[model samples]
Target: MVIEWLTLMVPADWHERFIAADTAIWTHFLAQQPGYVGKQIWRNPAKPDELTLLIHWQSRQQWKAIAPTALAAVEQEFRQNLGRSFDIIAANEYQPLADGSISSQRPMAD
Candidate 1:
């Protein structure tokens, strides 16, 4: 399985709106995509402005195969719904290892 991890920074005042729009837009869209397993949104009280999304897919190829245009459309809709842009603090992809641990391989520098 492949896990797509995304961390975004959103204002505290916008948390409720952000979660609503995200669930309404992203979760609904992702549910229709092939190889989409599930998703979870998380928050930490110490860092209320940060939201973490864990998107599960059957395989990395299936997730990456999603069309760029489709992704762009969804993103545009999300921004429009929120009436603002969000900052993605970090993005990473991980795969589950045989030992029941998740591992992310970083790209080598040139």
Candidate 2:
């Protein structure tokens, strides 16, 4: 399994808007993608402006296939259409270890 971790630093005032945008995309993925297993969205406990997205896929290829189109929509539609909402800081990706762990040996909590 592969996990795509997207850590975004968003503007504080636009949190709701960001969530709305993400929710839309999440719904889209759930409906159209068979390879998408699940996803989790997180926010920094300390920093209100930080958000983290964990997307699980069946394989890297499945993820890569949908990534470009989804990302382009997020960039062109969400970002451009709603620049007043927030500023995206960064995004990253990772593969699970043999033990099904990415950052730690322990399993991620539900």
Candidate 3:
């Protein structure tokens, strides 16, 4: 499987809103793609503003196949809705040592 790994820095005061926007981009945009498996959001206590996202896909090629235009739209929506760009620390892809299955999906925020 392929994973999209991203580290972001968002203000503590914007935590819930940031999560909502981020989750919307993932669930509403990425999840609509052909091979999306799941996504996970992680928070760092040491640096409250630090957040990490892992987006799983069936394969690297499938994930890369996502149309650039669609991605741009989602990013545009994120910025327009959230009012700021997340300070991205790291963004990359990875292959797990062993391809595993996720039994359950993340609960979407209302």
Candidate 4:
């Protein structure tokens, strides 16, 4: 499996809206994709302005296969409709342990 990790800076006032839009993108858009497994969002307790997102996919190949054009469209819609709520501070992708399916233990937990 593959995981997409993102750290973002979001204003406290926009937190709820930001999460809602982010959730919509994952549930309505990414979830419809061929390799999408699930996604998780988190807020930093010490830093209210900070947020994190983790998105899981069946494979890096299928995850990367998502067309940039389609992704751009979804992002554009998010910005146009929800307005800018956060700025991504960091983003990365990784493949799970080669040993076995460890993530299968807890599919999508807090």
TM-score of each: 0.86, 0.69, 0.84, 0.82
Instruction: Summarize candidate 1's per-residue lDDT along 1-110 as a digit string, tens digits.
Output: 99999999987888899989999999999999999999998997999999999999999999999999999999999999988899999999999875433455555699
Model 3 regions more than 4 Å off: 99-110
User: Per-residue lDDT of 1-110 in model 2, one digit per residue for the tens?
Assistant: 88878778786677777788767755464547767888887889798878888888888887777667766665666665466444456677778666734765675599
- Tens-place lDDT per residue, model 3, 2-104, is 8899999887888899889878775778878899999998888998988888999999999999889888888888999988888789999898885345755
Q: What is the RMSD, in Å, between candidate 2 and the native fold over all Cα? A: 6.0
Higher TM-score: candidate 1 or 3? 1
Per-model C-alpha RMSD: 8.2, 6.0, 8.3, 5.9
Query: Mind giving the per-residue lDDT tens digits that candidate 4 earns over 1-110?
Result: 88999998987788888888877764589999999999888888999898888999999898989999999999888887686635889999987775546865655677
| Candidate lDDT (C-alpha), each | 0.93, 0.72, 0.86, 0.84
- Candidate 3, pairs of clashing residues: none
> TM-score: which candidate is best?
1
Q: Which candidate would rank higher by TM-score, 2 or 3? A: 3
Clashes of 1: 0
Which order, best to worst by lDDT? 1, 3, 4, 2
Q: What total of clashing residue pairs does each candidate reach? A: 0, 0, 0, 0
Q: Which stretches of candidate 1 lie over 4 Å from their true place?
A: 98-110
Q: Rank the candidates by TM-score, best first.
A: 1, 3, 4, 2
